[model samples]
Target: MRALLVEDNDRLAGLLVTGLRRAGWTADVVDSLDAAIAACRTHQFDAVLLDRGLPDGDGLDMLRALRDAAPPPAILVLTARGGLPERVEGLNRGADDYLVKPVALEELVARLNAAVRRMRGGRRGPILVGRLEYDPISRAVTIGGVPFDPPPRERLLLEHLLQAMPRPLGKEALEERLDSFERGIGSNAVEVYVHRLRRRMEDMRAGVSIETVRGVGYRLRAVD
Candidate 1:
């Protein structure tokens, strides 16, 4: 999943970004409300980890703006203000979930997943397509109930394709979702991942195929 992390503290933001990447997330870090707003305008993030205190303004100020986004990303308010009224205010202001500071990475990720699941209509169970099964939370891939571990990039590509079944995901969209800003993404990067994943699925007889949509992009469909 892709996330926008709005935090001013350099050290904490770095740690969170590393932890999130380790947890299989592509995260973009911004330190101020202005930068966060700009990022929201630019990227299509699945969620936003918001810190209340910022150099320019209260982070909640941008909450309403973020809420206005089409298919708005799930918003989680992370702050040192743990007061009851503060938490209530944050939620009332359209935050999906609220977490006080000094949170464990595990707990943060769990809560973020829960929020995302709720946003996606509670699709928390394993996704089954033909003989292939994927557990979104665990990011585990299984074929005919046998565990299958692909390379990390391939795994991420499969997850995105599964989530976007039927509807083809454009190359640009796939590239944006799979990579972050710091890295220089190659033009054929998505194609490479797609090819690798397709080969693996075919070799495993997973009964699914990655179909190229010609001018569009790619879609995952069950084989006849």
Candidate 2:
């Protein structure tokens, strides 16, 4: 999952980003409401963690704008304003959930997941391609009902491939999707991960295969 965290507090933002990444999420931080608006315009995010007080104006203003988005992202109001009235106002203004400051990392992640699930209108069944099965909500992948756990990045790569299906995902697109602002990765990073994941799939006798398209990228195809 990808998230946009609009927070001016550098320390808090760093901690939240680190925690979210550890939980298998990609997160980007923007300090002000204007930056958040711009970031949202340029990148697609699964969730947005917003703060009420910002350097420019109230975070609720952004929430108002986000409600107009074609497919608005799940918004969580994470601010120090813990009062009941503030919480009510946030929800009324289109926040999927309102969480106060000093929240637990685990709880925050859980709430974010819950909010997203709610926005998605509950969980959908696992994606099945040949013998490979992937549970989008749980981030679990299996083959023929057996457990399959790869390293985080490899798992994410596999998910992207599975989701895209017949359409090949370009190498540049994969690199951008896998890249996080906090990490400095090599230009050939996508190739490395694809190679590792492809080898693992082969070793497990996975029914699906990663087919490389020369001058293009890669696609997942079910073996006959």
- C-alpha lDDT score of every prediction, in listed order: 0.89, 0.87
| Weakest lDDT window of 10 consecutive positions for candidate 2 | 176-185
Per-residue accuracy of model 2 over 181-217 as CA lDDT, tens digit each: 6674688998899899978888788888888999889
Best by lDDT: 1
The runs of at least 3 residues in candidate 2 whose Cα sits more than 4 Å from the true structure, single-residue gaps closed, are 144-146, 213-216
Separately for all candidates shown, the number of backbone clashes (residues 3 or more apart, or on different chains) is: 0, 0
Position 161, candidate 2: lDDT = 92
Q: Per-candidate RMSD vs. true structure? A: 1.7, 2.3
lDDT of 1 by residue, 83-186 (tens): 99999999999999999999999999999888887788876778888889999867788998888888666777888999887799999989988887666469
State the TM-score for model 1.
0.93
Best by TM-score: 1
